[model samples]
Target: MVSVALPQIGTRLSASPTGLQWVVDAYVLVYAALLVPGGTLGDRLGRKRTYLAGVLIFGAGALTCALASNLPVLLAGRALQGVGPALLVPGSLTIVRSLFHDERRRAHAIGLWSTASGLAMAVGPALGGVIVAQWGWRTVFWINVPLAAVLATTAWYAVPDVPGTGRQSGERDGDARRTGLLADLDIPGAVLITAGLAASTYATVVGQSAGWGSAVFFVSTSITVLAVGLFVRRERRHREPLVDLNLFLRRDFLAANLAGLAVFFAFVGAIVYFSIYFQHVRHQGPIAAGLSVAAIGAAFAVAAPISGRLTHRFGPLPPLTGGLLLAAAAFLSLTPIGAHSGMVLIIARFVALGAGVGLALTPMTQIAVQAVPDGRAGMASAVHNALRQQGQVFGVAVLGAIVYAHQDYLTGFRIALLTSGLVLLAAAITTLLLPTRRPRPASGRSRHQ
Candidate 1:
């Protein structure tokens, strides 16, 4: 909804390109930073309770955004909204982990999750357009109000409560106590990663505006490096770390996350340019431009479940590799697209892109969680989501910078598509190297720990 209405927001707020980018990045920034702690917190508390709390926060944020009188107020509202997804996303996935015992069934459920997400993307633009056209941009935020209410109500009644495994019988007092809220929260680790990623995001945005060699960029980048370094060191030494760094030892886990990050990096980064091209270059209305991109969502919604089933049967490698290749092909197809390109060509490539995303995302989600012990499902889910969202921030910022640098929108669009294609291709090759077999537990941890 925010993506579709960004142009309107920019126009009304008299925003520069950098300000527009912040409208999107601000929400994603906080979401990515808080996800690890959010997931771990949910695991310590209860998934359903955490999830409902997130919904309420999201609803309140939406209300704040709808009522905002200025850009700063809007950004603050977006920041608040970010907190909801941090808690909501992993908690929802943890619920899936709780419900499905068999790996195959879990994969199928995750596929459904991907499909639903795709469907929302499909409908969002058109829905948002109608709301924006009728009631103005503020109404778009109001739409989330009813939706969140329904989600919260249904979830409370329908979703089962999953108890925390923070305390188990026959464990040493120290080990069992480590699972408690205080020990598991990993506050110092969370603070470091949050500051690091925030600095990194700020650096990218500032570098584009103020030049990469500017003092602000240099300072922010330095903070990013230092913060990230301290985060790694702290996680390695901390008991009950926010992210279990040891999980990366699993080939499947590492590859799937890397691949997922690449895929989102391409998708999110490229779409902002697509929106820009349609609105600025082609002079299309927001609704028309959004509808033009709907092909990807429609295709993804249809394909994701099938891909999930395939992953369940043949392992993640085949679908993941094939999907990346398909996405790369789609990106290449976009290279020739210009202000005068025909709708048919654009629609075809969008469908191809959507299919690729649908095919790959489910398996990536499946692998990230499956590689870990059931006890760590929430943390694993959060880590995957956080990386994926971080990839979006980088993708949008970097590609937007490329677009902003070029006077010609076509040149910038071409560069972004080509760059995204290269990334997808690289991910494809990486997918080929991922383990072909279903993951067994790493670290000798049993399912229940």
Candidate 2:
């Protein structure tokens, strides 16, 4: 999000379109690919320990990204930052879940945590914009340093270690003991998956700009697909696979993950472009543009808690469906943004979009975690994030193609908004596959052995 001004910055680069796409897409791709493994590592190590390490790495990466002078350097640093987030975010949630064992307390804790995250995610763009406008784009990444420091220091003292009762317990009693869950990881499978994902992203970034028939694009895409196929084959045979293949057989788990992809695809693809449209078409300055974009986060601040409460009362259907519908409606409203749309319309649409995203986030994460057993929560969360990051990358690839061809900022954004709305609506429809209550096996145990 700190790189939301990338379109503006790309003009200063050697390869404008490709560089900009790589800037955003590379970060998301690395984030998605590494996330599951990072969480698995957390489960093996202490969540607190991994969480602290992830934060420190993330902070350092952020600082590195801020100091970057060239596009390649910036991208490398951003990649590190992206990987760090994949670790920290899931670890943070798992930590909370591990700490609060009681159902009621966990529910409330998760709700608050969701609200805060939604608010921050929603507001992040605006904050980035303000910093970018006032100081420069580099300053956007710099702000992360102090905040991360404060969090790490305070949490070090305050946070109690989550007992290793489940998966973590399988690892304890120190070294030299390799038990069932503590079995050596399928490191090859992990490498294969990451390389596949990264290569696929490279293909996406290149193919849209250069023809798909281009040598580099075809080689990259082919290698990616080949690696993925090999990864699946390897995981199926491995004693302890990185991603347990059987989880997809569950309809609920599958639905939640698919919906997660659709939701994030819409968000990253649309929101970032909208920031550009606000400034370029509406003739607004960077600050006003960022604020207009950030309005969604403000709406999230209010709606996230409400969505959680609604989920508690009526299950995810009501809020999830209604929110998606409202978001679609808001998006449809934006289709008419011609050469002269008023401020009111923009604000109204932004507010609606914000609320829609707020409703989505918690429900999405909740569904993913609930789909798996308590022990597999970290892995499930990692999958959820990875799928969504894929969605975001896909969105960028798809919508970016449309934008590059059109070259009219407003038209491109409306197309993006329309695409986003459709995706969320599809997600809302997909929610029907989600079980209203976590299904209990007839024999009353987790489906896993």
Candidate 3:
């Protein structure tokens, strides 16, 4: 939705290419930064409470965006919007984890969740386009307000409250108070990671526009290294680290996260560039561009549920590897597209891209969650989502730089697609080579073991 509205935003707000990138990155950066904290909070507080609060915050952010008169205000609103998702995404997944105990049932439930997400992704662009065409880009933001309200109301009535860590049956509130919520949370670690990610993304996005030799890039690069270095050290030492460094020791967890990063990097970069190409290069209106991008979402919605079933019948390895390979092939196919390319070829590539993502996303998420103990489901979900969000940030920052640096949009587009294809290909190979672990039945054994 935001992708299709970007051109209109640029024109209306008098924004530069770099500013446009910030419009997207601002939301993703804040969302990625707070995900771990949000998940931890959900674990310590209540998942239901956190989820509802997030919805309210998200609605407020949407309202703010709809009313924004300047780029700064819009960016701020986008950042606020990020805050809401940070809390809600992990909370929702944790709820699902709690509800479904059986492995197959859980996988199928996750598939349904993914399907809902895919449908949203599918509808957002086309709907945003129609809204933007009819009422302007600002109207696109306005729609979220009503939807958020409905979701909050429905969830309050329908969703059950899941106890936070240490708050299970027969446990008293005193147990949770032993360490205190703030004491249990790694605030310093969160701050360090957030700062590191922001600095790194800033450097990446600004480097091409400001020149690599510029003081802004150099300083940001230094900060990035220093902050990330400090964050790693802090997480290693902290008792209740925002992210458990040990989770990476599990081969399945590591592979799933890496694959997640690669998949999102390619998917998000492609979406942004494709939207731009349809509108700016192909001279399509917002409605047409939205409809064009809808092919990806439509195919995704169709494939995600089926992938869940496949993952249940076979191991995650088959679908995960195949999906990545398919996405890579789609990226490679898209490399030759130009302003004059036929609609059939473009739509076909988009559909393939969508299907690959749908197939892989569910199993990837399942693998990550299953790798950890039930106690850490929220944390695991947060870690996976956080990495995915980081992938989005890097995708936009790096790929957008490539596109803008080249005078020819087509050349830049081709190069970006080729780079994405290679990245996916490498991820696919890595996933294939990693040890395969079938999801176990609901026996009392640890899946990680």
**Against the true structure, whose lDDT is highest?**
3
TM-score of 2: 0.88
Cα displacement (Å) at residue 77, model 2: 2.0
Candidate 2 global Cα RMSD:
4.9
TM-score of candidate 3 to 2 decimals: 0.91
Ten-residue region with minimum lDDT total, candidate 2: 440-449
Per-residue lDDT of candidate 2, residues 1-449 (tens digit): 55666755675555477677677776777887788787776666557777887888889888887888788888888888887787788788888777765444455566677778566766677676666667777777788888789889977888876432233334431122336434576788888988887887778778877876799999998999999999999989988777888888887778778877887788767776776676777677766776777777778777877776667666666676777777767777777777577877778888988788777666666767767655567777777777877787788778777766676766666676677778787888887877676422222231221
Can you tell me which runs of candidate 1 are displaced by over 4 Å? Answer: 10-18, 167-180, 438-449
Count of steric clashes across candidates, in order: 0, 1, 0
Report the lDDT tens digits of candidate 3 across residue range 26-83.
8876788788778878877777888888899999999999999999999999999989
List model 1 lDDT by residue over 1-449, tens digit each: 78777778888888787788788778877888788888887777667778988998999889898998889999999999999989989999988988987766777789998898888878888778877887888888988998899999999889877755564555421133543546547788888988887888778767867887899999999999999999999999987787889989888888889998898899977876786788888999888877877788899999899997888778888888888899999998889788789888889889999999899999888889888876788899998998898788778778877777788879887988999999999998877657667644323332343
| Residue clash pairs of candidate 1 | none
List where candidate 2 sits over 4 angstroms from the true fold.
4-17, 69-71, 163-183, 438-449
Q: Which 10 consecutive positions of candidate 3 have the poorest summed lDDT?
A: 440-449
Error in Å for residue 394 of model 3: 1.2
